[model samples]
Target: MPGSVIGINMNYGYPGQASRHGDEVSRTRPVATTSEKIMFGAPVVQNTDGSVKAWEAASTAANFAGVAMRKVKAAKIYPYQNFGYYGAGEPCDVLLRGGISVVCAWGTPTIGGTVYVRTNVAEEGSPEEAKIGDFGAEDESGNCIALTNAKWSSSKDERNVAELTILTRQGV
Candidate 1:
């Protein structure tokens, strides 16, 4: 056994597989498609009537990121594009991916608080978590390059990217 290298094998489970409101259902962890583009939310098209049209299920998706859980897949958390405050500190969960990625981050404060990801949940701890001010940026929890501060401009009127920002009680 000496001088021999051994491979380590471990069992891993997907994160937060589901939630409970009534019946059981999958919590929305999508897989990466071969196309490299991982689409989320719904189709948003500018209609000929000079209005924005959205094609999505009107439900829980607002609080969750519906993106693939695979590395190399790109994602866009389009819903958080609005801002507000969640007094309960209900977290805005975004997906994570690795490799080349193009992402746009957005969110309105539902309550007077900030945005956190991964172990950053209240019951969870920080230092090894992601935190950012309102209207900031954070990489997908799984594919996080690191626990980044949300990277974006402030005042809701601006859109920049930061390692973190504060979720205030205001809006753009």
Candidate 2:
């Protein structure tokens, strides 16, 4: 007998994972020595010296690099152990143009809507404090900034991960 379907389709993959094969354009770059830990699926920017770093709210659209891609490492032996992030000076793959999954740090993701990045703390001295590089759908005034040439490809799933499509390479 065949199995029965119960629910609607949802994104069930790890962050920074390519939604499909062969359509992504990526480039390898080393993390800047002064850069902080960069999580997979977070947006990045290119420094003047040609190294990559986590994208901050102060960064202009012209400096936008791309989203970081997840790399399989021996340390990440299990799927649940894949929360690791890349440190300074490590080589990372940046998706220049593609469909990739990312976490919606705040705000609901809407298909074909503009993508925003959290620029400031949502609440001071609270666990809900927003971090740089977090994605969202609304601008929230001064707390978030819109990303250029990027859009939400799908709504977020139960895990708050959604598909983001980069239409073109920004700042490069």
Candidate 3:
């Protein structure tokens, strides 16, 4: 399933306690109508007008927004205002941190492995096998963008899905 398939406790924090379970750590922003297919935990970047899109290596730190919180359509208006609409784009709630995201596994992600967004090129040892959006113990290529908060409790298969927490919004 896509990361957009959220649990009932939508705003719950990672390893969230029952007392503060309902608190929202996410923020809402408009997404570009031409934005890429952003899954629940995918990284995104922002435009000068505050419209968000998927994070790419070409973007700088200032363009980095946060993670997608829902499966939003392009050009659909949200309840708040005429903020998101066709040509105007759609609004997507973003989870800056303290939220769980189901991301793709580049390799077997360990409990304490570091999460990174893969570039167009493959990893050093994993030739012909792409390692984009993969979590690993080391970053050899220097092309990996770190998602500092994410961690996996169990190992995941390559190209499989696993849930992780958004610990911080440190863009690299």
Candidate number of the best lDDT: 2
Return the TM-score for each candidate structure.
Answer: 0.19, 0.86, 0.58
Predicted structure 3, TM vs. truth? 0.58
| Overall lDDT per candidate, in order of appearance | 0.24, 0.80, 0.51
Which segments of model 1 are wrong by more than 4 Å?
1-37, 40-57, 61-70, 73-159, 162-172
Query: How accurate locally is residue 38 in candidate 2, as Cα lDDT from 0 to 100?
Result: 82
Candidate 2 per-residue lDDT, tens place, 29-114, comes to: 89999988788888899987778998876876667788888877556435553465778999978899989989987778788999
* Candidate 2 lDDT: 0.80
Those runs of model 2 whose alpha carbons end farther than 4 Å from true positions after fitting are 1-9, 76-81, 124-129
Q: How far is candidate 3 from the true structure (C-alpha RMSD, Å)?
A: 8.6
Ranking by TM-score: 2, 3, 1
Q: Which ten-residue region of model 3 has the weakest summed lDDT?
A: 12-21
Clashing pairs in 3: 75-85, 75-86, 118-132, 118-133, 149-167
Q: After superposition, how far is residue 36 of candidate 3 from its true place, in Å?
A: 2.8
Candidate 1 lDDT, 1-172, residue by residue in tens: 7543563532121221111223221122222221122222111112233222221222121222222222222223434322211111122222222111112233332222233333222334323332321121333443212223122222222232222221121111
